[model samples]
Target: MDAFAIQRQLTGIEPLNGSNYTTWRTSVDIMLGFLDYEFVLYEEKPAAITEESSEAVKLLYAKWTKANTIAIRLIRASIGETIRGDIPVFNTAKALQYYYLTQFMSTSYDGSGSVREHIYKICKLVNGLRE
Candidate 1:
């Protein structure tokens, strides 16, 4: 996911960056909150891994990705439901395209062809706009 790359990049800080590790953690929490929960007030649960657990860092990244994926699904469901209610508004090709555009740029990636096409169209439009 592009967000995986972005989230990883955001937290990749050198110790000399004047921002502490805690700050990066908080940033991640904030982003996660925006993607899912309204606020992030919860007990910090220690990962229940055995001593034989391998690749702790990879596991942690997977967990983070999973959490974000759930959030994306919830958001998509909500948005799709909301948009579907506009059957009256969706009576025309322009309206359908407009709605698709709205849902498109905001959609989360799930490795679907439709999603890839949406990304490609958005990128094409964005490039055109930029030029």
Candidate 2:
């Protein structure tokens, strides 16, 4: 896509909801790719280039770095609120991955002994294992 289209898409990105972390994360990655920005997942913040870098190069790097930071902040704010106390304040994408894996895929339903409860538990177990 063109620059304007990519910029518009990035600016229009939505915050993540509880159940859509995977979808939202995928969308963000696609948008970043459109803009030629790195996904920056599971990594420390990038280091700035040396003093020998040209003004235009520095500016581009700075803008790319800002966009990466914004993505992480948006992720933490969106997922953190949805998961509540399950996540800590200084969260990361790795933590979100773990939470997504354990919580959403968990099959430990607490239903008491009944036909429906048995069915749900079995389904949950199967789905959890599949995940």
Q: Which candidate wins on TM-score?
A: 2
* Candidate 2 C-alpha lDDT tens digits along 1-131: 87688667766666554445456667676765665554555455445788898888788677757766665565454443544444444333334445445555554546567877656445433432332
Candidate 1 ranges beyond 4 A from true positions: 1-54, 80-131
Per-residue lDDT tens digits of candidate 1, residues 1-131? 37786466444422212123345335544544555532212323235566666787558645654554554333233232333243234322123334555655675667667876666546533422221
Task: Give each model's whole-structure lDDT.
Answer: 0.42, 0.54
TM-score of 2: 0.39
- The deviation in Å at residue 59 for candidate 2 is 8.6
